[model samples]
Every structure is written in C-alpha cells, then in structure tokens.
Target: MLDLGITGVQWYARIPGTIGGAVFNNIHGGTHFISEVVKKVKVLDKDNKIRTLSGKALGLSYDKSRFHDFAEIILSVEFELFRGDAKRAKQVAFEWAKRKSLQPPRSAGCTFKNISNEDKERLDFPTTSAGYIIEHILKMSGYKIGGAKVSTSHHNFVVNDGDATAKDYTTLVKLIQKETKKKLDIDLVPEIIFLGEFWFGNVPGCQGGGVSSTPFEERVVWD
Candidate 1:
C-alpha cells in the first residue's frame, strides 16, 4: 500500500473504505478519485501474462477502471507521494478521526457522488456534498425505510441500526437515488460495495443474481 501522506485535506476524511476498494469503486472524495493518482498499474491478463499500463492506457472514470471490469486481480498498486512532516500529518489525521466519530457506527459511508459542479450551480444547490443534498431533501435528522435509516449525523450514510437487513439497505439506497434524480435531475451512485450474494442479487443491471460463482471474497478486516 502506498501512502500519499495527504494532510489537512478532506480527501481522506470520513471515507471508510481502503485504497484497494477505493480503486475498485472509483471512489472520488474531495478533488479526484484514486485513478488520478495512479502512475502505473501492473496487470496479469487471462493468460497470466504480466503487463504494465500507464497514463491514459488504463481508462478510468467515475469509480471504474477498464481493467477492474475484467478478471484481473491487483497484486499490488503504486501511487505517487511527496515528502511531508509526520507530526502535521498526524494532526490532520486526528482531526479527521474526530469528525468521522460524529457519524453513525453502522454506516458504510456516503451513498452517492455529487453531480458535476456545473450542474450543481445551475440547480442552485447549496453544497456539492452528497450528504448535504440528502439532508436538504429529508429535512430531518434521519430518514427510515424499514430498519434502514439515513444517518442523523450524515444523510449520505444509511445506517444498519442493528435491525436493518440486506433488503432494507438495498431498498433505502434505491429510494435515495430515486429522490435525488427526481428533485435535482442528478443520479447518485452507491459508494459502499455490496458483497457476497447481495452484489449479484441486489445490484441493478447485473446478470444472474445471488453473488458471483467465484469462490473468492475480497474484504478488509483490520485487527
């Protein structure tokens, strides 16, 4: 894992996923997604031939990569970083942690990406943040669908609240997307990964529901 030592920036603030998942999801926080920082990617094709792609060779946008859509597995990734002070970096990280603590514990983090700045400005949107947009629509601390609830602290996050089922979460996400589009004419995409059978069964437009036939499951469990 390559650390860019990004400090005092909201890019690393409150995002709950990892570098690998961020790469896979095309997660863009403040300025740009991980794709923007990628210098090169080493890939193994179907025949197991090792190849390297750099610059525009690897097509990327929104939370997607051309290689990510395929069967290729990322052995490791390299990122561009700069020298910085450890103390200042720690201070930034601490502030971020404090801010994130205000969010619900059961959340998977932001549920959507903001529309482009041009569109937002045209709509007279107050904030480009997805959480801000949801808050405006709901006009409450939280919005509930069955056991799932849009977090009181942050709207973009749908919290499990102990009683939420996979179905509840999925339904709530759909509702958020529908509302956002209806009101703002912008589509909000999910940031959290729907794992296991849920991915195939729940995700729209995916072929053959109820998980991939592959045996592998990619998850991050920090001790």
Candidate 2:
C-alpha cells in the first residue's frame, strides 16, 4: 500500500495484491483512501484474456471499486504521484503510526468513515473521524458486547476481550453505528473487511439503516 502524504501522487512497493484487487479497492494510505491515487489497472479475465482499464473506467470511491462487480483478476496497478519531499512523507507516516498505536491490538481497523465536511459543519463538530464520533456516542471506556468491547484507549476500535466471536464483534459494531447516528445524525462506514460468517450474515445493519459488507473482490491490499 502507498502513503502519499498531502500530495495526490504516491509510489508503492511491498504491497501483496495482484493489481486487480488494488484497482478494485483503490487501495491507498494516510488521510487518503484508495479512491484518489489509482490511474490504471491490468486485469486477467476468467477466460484468461488480458485487458487494461484506465481513468474513469475504474470506478473508485471510498474503499470501493467497480471491479468488485466483475470476476476479473488484477495483474498490476499504476498510480499517479506528485513530486514531494521524502522527509515530509516519512514524518507524516510516523504520525499515522503513532495514532494507530493507540488503537486496540488484533482488532479490526476503523469501524466507520467520518461524515462529510458539510455534515460535520452542520453538527458543529471540530472533526469527523469515526473514532471521535464513537468516543462521544459510546463514552469509550468499559463498553462491551459479549467478548467484544470498546478499546479503553480508543473508541473506533472494537477489541476482542478473548473468546470473542464474529457475532460479538459485529454486535458491537452495529451498536456503535446505531448510537452514533442517533446522536450525531451521521452514518459511519466500516473500514475493515469482514471475513467468514457473521451473526447476521455479511451485510450487517446499523441503526440508521446503514450497512457494511465485504468488498466483492478478495485480495490483500497491505503487505
């Protein structure tokens, strides 16, 4: 995965997916997610035919891609990058690492996407990070759903307090999403991919009728 600082351009190495999954998810890093950086993707179809998709052909938004609807496999991806200082990139990455360290270990990543800027402004909230919303809604510490609990250190993370099942984890996720929407009028989107069977099947629902589903494409986006 690539972490491209504030500039839109990034160079990536050490990622483990065939170019297909990357294109499908628009995999990216830092404050930016996958939708912003990808330029093109080469793919191999089910019949083993090779093709290249470029520009708008690769529909990307948030952590989603149009490739999710196709059965093609990705071979490689090309990304757009900007000229930038290496030192700044490293500094930004370091900051991200520090923030990530405060989250729960062995837990799914951020449980929701922050609301849009207009929505945040409407709510008079200083920021729209899902962690911030969850912290306010759940009150963070000591919150639990079966074997899953809100991280004492961070709200967006649902930690497995040992023996946690998919049900426990998913239940907590729904609860957080529900409460956040009720209080803030903003829907939260999940960042982590759910694997295997969940308590209510893959597309789990939130209180505000929001749903989180596994991306159709099955590929690793991180190294």
Candidate 3:
C-alpha cells in the first residue's frame, strides 16, 4: 500500500497474515479495523456460485465476520483508501513495526479476543483487553506448559520456545481459559482459528469439529 501511495492500511504493517485473512478476521490495530477500509468483496457462496457482498452482508465486526459462520470463498476485495505520501506512510509503518517489536518471535499472535464491552462493564474492569486480564488479573504471564509458554513480553501471545507440538500449544490455550474462568468467571474466547482436531477443554464455541475437508465449510476465505 505504501508503495502504491495508499494510506489507511499502515496499521496492517504490524499484523500477520494476508489482506484477505485480515478481512475474514476483521483484524484490528490500535483503533483502526480492516473493516473500515473494506468496500466490497466477491465470493463463491455455498451454492457454488459467485456473488458480491458488501456492508452488512459481510457481517464485519471486532475480530469477527460472516466468514466465521458461513462457508464462502473470497475471490476478491475492494478497499477504500486515501492517496497519501508514500514517504509518510512508510514512516508510520516503520514506527508501528518498532512499537510491535515485542511480539513473540515464534507465535500465532494474540491467543484470545479482547473482552466485549458488555463483559468489561459487567466485570467493572477498566479495559477490555484480554492481555491485561491474563497478565494483571490472573498473573499468568510467563506461564508455561510443555514447550508452549505465555510470552512475558506480551501476555496474549503463546510462544513456542522450541520443540513445542500442536498439543503443547492447545494445552497452553486450555490452561489460559481454565485460569481465566476460575479467577474471573469469564470465558476467554480464542482468536486463532483451529486447523485440525485438537483438545479444547470444553471451551464454548470451540467444542469438537476440526477443519472440514471442504474448503467452503466454515472456512476463512482469503481474497
């Protein structure tokens, strides 16, 4: 985007994954969300037919989208952007990259979604951040299971300190959920999508069901 003299997506510089994945997850950075720039998307619907969906049809929201519930293949996407100085955009991206330098070197990014505003208010918490709850409330930073460890630098990230298997990662995630529920009575929702069948320890919305053989079956379609 910077090379193309486009702005508004500089926040994505610190985010992992493709643009389509960002849209699918409705990924956000700071106060800006990918959904803010989305204009429309072309998709292959469940009927095996092509369709264009825009606005509410996409069901874009915080760290969520219709892609979470529907089986569709994203073919292409149009984004609204502003013409900006490439030099300025690059500078902003560089700044964001440096600020996010604490991200775990080997991790899948944030493990849990931020608490919803409703939960935050109900819990009487000052912030809706799941990382804050993990690190401050539960005091689970640096907690480890097998080779998977909750990153001390950023509590939301679970890092693989080498030799960490898929089971190790899933086990650590379950532990986080367990501790959160036990301490705060809040169910921490996972942010990363599960690929294969794995243990989820009775986490709501994540019980049973692994990645399906069909690509369009409750899949994240990258445009």
Candidate 4:
C-alpha cells in the first residue's frame, strides 16, 4: 500500500493475516494498531445475517475485538487512510521489510511479551528482555523438540523445521515456559492462538504432534 502512497497500513506490512483477521486481533506494531485505521466492519452473525458495525462497536483493544470468541465471521472491512509521500513511505516500508526479513521465514512470533518495567523490578530481572531470559538465562537458542526449534536467528520465536506437528510446537512452548519458570522464576505466556486441540506432556494412546497431511515450508505467519 505504501508503494502506492498509502500510509496507514505501513505498520502492518509484516502481518500475515487477512484484513478481517488483522482487525479481529487489532494487529499492531510499535505504537500503531489496526483499530486506528478501520472505518467500519461487516460481519455475519450466528444467524447468518449480515451486520454492519461502527469501529467503536467492534470494541477493538489490546490484541482483542468483539468478534473474538463471539463466533462471528468477519466478512469485510473498510479503512480510512491518507495519501503520503510514496518515496518517504517506501523508505519506511523498506526499513520494516528489512527488519522482518531477518526473522525466520516460518515461526511463531515472540514467544512472550516483554515484562513491564515494574514487573521487571518485581521479578528482579536485570532488564525487561524475554529474549535475554531465553538466550542468556535458559540458553535455549537453536534448541529443538521434535520438529520445533528455537530460531537461531531470533531467540523470541520457535521455527517449525518442516513437518512439525502442533504437538511439536506445544511441546516447545512448554519447554520454554518450564525452563523460564525454573531458571528465572518468571512465567512466560504465548501470543500464538492454537486453532485446534493441543497435546502436552505424556499421555497414553496419544501423540501430540498435530501433523498435517502435507508439510510445507513457507514464509512464517506470526499470530
């Protein structure tokens, strides 16, 4: 969009979701969010009736929207954006694109939100760095369980090394959570949204890796 002189969507160029999904999750980067540009949204209610909602009716907020867990299907969205200098916008997009290109092509986004300054002080962590905790404290860079591994390129993500099952991902999540708690006494929460059943730990007659029929290695989509 920025290449065409659109500016509002520059912050979300890296997001892998559709327009509706972005609004549903209030997708954001730095100080900007999808809520800021959304003019309105159209959704299908449980009765399969179409409803037009004002931006405020969507109740968008920190990683949340009314459509979340409401079982409504987002049909479309309208955005209000302004014209900007294409040259300047392209420069910004290029910078963001450059930074995004550094992370794994396929991996969950940051495993956890950074601890707040107050939380950092309360936890006695020298700094509010979740990546620091994973790498410096847990020493888990490039660590793996099944097909899931901590990205050597970035400590905040778990890369699916092709053919990974949901179990592989969850197991890795558990490992990070477990290790962080054990080593730093701080609990790490995930930002990924699991769409289906996830298995953890050993269970009789159960294998946690939720393998798909065909494996794919593609641009990593972060949630």
Candidate 5:
C-alpha cells in the first residue's frame, strides 16, 4: 500500500489468505516473503497470553516459520516496507500474479515446495523443481485418480474438476511420490497441509472408507 507516497509492503499483496496464514507459511512472491516485511507479530500463545514476537524470534526461513505448527493464534502483524515507485510496484505484483495464474484454477498453488539445498545434495538431484521430476521424468502431469488430476499446465498442481474428495487428492499424491521414489530414489514431501483425517489403509480408522463415512467412501480408489 502507498501512504503519502511511501510504500508499506508489496509482497503481502501476492498472497491470498490472511496475514496469519501468510506468516505461518512464510508466504512469498518474487524473491522475498512476509518474513521480510514483517517487523513483528502478535500471537495468542497456547497459554492464552498475547505476546509479541519479532521476526528473528520466530526463526523465519524458506517456506517455514515457527508458527507453522505451534498452538497459537496470530492476532496481527506489523510490517515495515520500503518506498518504491508506484508503477514499479504494480509491475512487480502483476508479473507475480501472472505467474501464479499458470497453475490449475481449482488447485492448490504448489503441492511440493522446492527441495532444500541440503536435501537436493543428499538425494543426488540436480534441479530444485520437484515438478520437473514428476512432469519431465515421471510424466505425471494430467495424471488422474478418481476426480482429481495433476495439472497438465504444471505438474505440481492437483486439480479437482468435479466432486473430488480428499481421498482422490491423497491417492494421486501418493502415486506420484511412490513413482518418483522408485524411479529417482528421491522422496518428495508435500507442501499442502491435510486438515482432516487421511485414511490410507495403513491408518487405523481407514477401512477403505467403508467403516462409516459413506460420503468419504465414494471417493476412495478401487475400494
């Protein structure tokens, strides 16, 4: 935002959700993220006490922040931004949004975060694009499971075209991971979070979704 010709932040404009989620996921566009502009954040800790946390105190890093799993409520954030030309800011944000629009309209942004440098070396993978491995090598773009399909536009996006369910998404995700692991000896971790229970047979509650949850059963694969 521009205030009397001074800019507060441009990065936050790129993210879709609230500031809390942005900080939690280290939401980024362009090269910087919320962590860069955030001066401090006020969070309600598990003890129900409101406390202010500085950026460094949160240990903000690439695609991660202390708030990721901590039991706390992010009340608000304080940002410190630089003053830049209005046209330049708009151009930057436009470029970022244009890039984001290339993915599936119904899908999550990126299913898998870029591999860390250390993990990349350990896995003997040369490139950072996990999507490349899935799309180029594994050839999984447009791969489908039930109602969900990997975005042909970008391999990482999982799109729900119709009445898709969690099972469809998870099944496709597992299939990709399994294939990638078998082919490249690399284990790809997901960036998206699973909110509800994931019943994948190995888990105790999941009996191929036939135990009780009828609504969830229709979505499971080969059940």
Candidate 6:
C-alpha cells in the first residue's frame, strides 16, 4: 500500500501473516487494530457461496472475531485509508520492524495476551502488559519446564531450547497460567493457537472450535 501512497494500515506492516489471518485474529500493532481500517470483506461461506460482509459483521475485538464461530474463508478485504507520505510510512514500518527484531527467533512470539485495562486496575496491578507481570512481578523470565523456557529477552514468549515437544510446550504454558493465577488472581490467557490432541490439562482459556470431523476440526484451541 505504501507504494501507492496509502498510510492507515501501516500498523500491520510488522505483523507476519496474510490479510485474512489479520482479520480473523484482529491482530493489533502498537495501539491500532487491523479491524479499525477494515471497510468490507468478501468471504467464501460454509455453503461455498461468495458473500460480501460489512466490517461490523466481523465482530472484531481484542484478538477475537466472529470468524472463530463461522466456517468461512476470507477471500478479500477492503480498507478505508488515505493518501499520505510514502516516505513516512516506510520510516514507521522500518522502526516497528526494528523493535520486533529484538524478539527471540526460536519462539512463536508472545505466548499470552496482556491483561485488560479494567482487570489491571481492579486487580491493583502496575501495568496491563503480561510480559511486565511475568518478568517484574512474578519474576519468571527464563523460567522453564523440560525443553521449553520463558524467553529472557521477552518474558511472555515461550522459546524452544532445541528439543521441545508438544507436551513440554503445553506443560510450560500451563505452569505459567497456574503461577499467574495463583499470584495475582489473573488468568494469563494464551494468544497462541494449539492443534492436534495436545493435552492442556487444567488450562483455563483453551476450548475446541472450527469445523468438525475433518482436518480443520479442533485446529483452534482458543476460546
């Protein structure tokens, strides 16, 4: 878009995924959400019919959307944007990418969503960031179980130290959830999606979704 002098959606420049994934996840960068600029969407519905949907139908809110409930595939999207300085857009995107470069390479990015602002104030926490809580409050940066360890570079990231298994990953996540809940009465909900039959045990936020009786079935364990 920057090539055409577009500016509004530059917040997504550092996000790693397709436009469809951005809308489905309602992924946010800085303080801007991808949903903010979305004007319309074209989707392949469950019936395999093409349909146009207004942006409001997306049900977008902090890492959520109606896409979680519908068996649809996003075919295309329209965004409301404005003509702006391509030079500035490039600069902004470059800065965001530079910041993201500090994250560890062996991880799937942040493991948990930050606590809601309401929850932060109600619980008497210092900040809404989950990484802050884990690193500064819980002091669990570099905390580990099996081959999975919380990244010291970023506390909310769970990085694999060479030989991690699905079991190890889930186990470490559960431990973080348990500790956060125990210490602060706050549930550390994961932002990561789990597939297959990985045992989450007593993890609070995971639930089954997507199509049933097929490969897509149980693909997203987020709720």
Could you estimate the TM-score for every candidate?
Answer: 0.73, 0.72, 0.81, 0.79, 0.80, 0.85
Q: Return the clash pairs for model 1, or none.
A: 26-63, 201-210
CA deviation > 4 Å runs, candidate 5: 2-12, 117-127, 199-223
lDDT of 6 by residue, 1-223 (tens): 7888989877666667898889988989889898888999999998999999999999998887878777789999999988988899888888878878887888877899899999888878788889998898889888878889989988889999888887788788877888888888888878876654353322333334222333222343332
What lDDT tens digits, residue by residue, belong to model 4 across residues 1-223?
6656778777666667688778877988767888998988889998999999899898898677887547688899988998977787677667777777787877867767676678688767787877877888889999988889888878888888988787788778877888888876776766565542242123332233332222111111222
- lDDT score, candidate 3: 0.80
Q: What does each candidate score in C-alpha RMSD?
A: 6.7, 7.2, 5.5, 7.1, 6.2, 4.4
Best by TM-score: 6
Between candidates 1 and 4, name the one with more favorable lDDT. 4
- Segments of candidate 1 deviating more than 4 angstroms: 1-18, 84-90, 195-223
The regions of model 3 sitting more than 4 angstroms off are 1-5, 84-91, 121-126, 199-223
Q: Better model by lDDT, 2 or 5? A: 5
Clashes per candidate, residues 3 or more apart or on different chains: 2, 7, 0, 4, 0, 0
lDDT of 3 by residue, 1-223 (tens): 6888889888778776786788888988778888988999999989999999985689897777888678888889989889988898798789778877868889998888888889899989999999999899988899888899989989899999888998888888877888889988888888887774354333445445553433322342211
Error of 1 at 141 (Å): 3.8
Q: What is the lDDT of residue 53 in candidate 4?
A: 89
Question: What is candidate 6's TM-score against the reference?
Answer: 0.85
Local accuracy of candidate 5 as per-residue lDDT tens digits, 32-101: 7677778988999989999999878887876767765466788998888777787777766677677765
Of candidate 1, the 10-residue stretch with the lowest lDDT total is: 214-223
Ranking by TM-score: 6, 3, 5, 4, 1, 2
For model 1, residues 1-223, the per-residue Cα lDDT tens digits are 1155543333465567665565556666556566766777777777898877773666678766665556665555677655566567666656766877786787777766666788778878777778887887645347787889888877778898779987888888877777777877787766565654455543344444422323212321111
Model 2 clash number: 7
lDDT of each: 0.65, 0.63, 0.80, 0.73, 0.72, 0.80
For candidate 5, the TM-score is 0.80
lDDT of 2 by residue, 157-177 (tens): 788898888778777777776
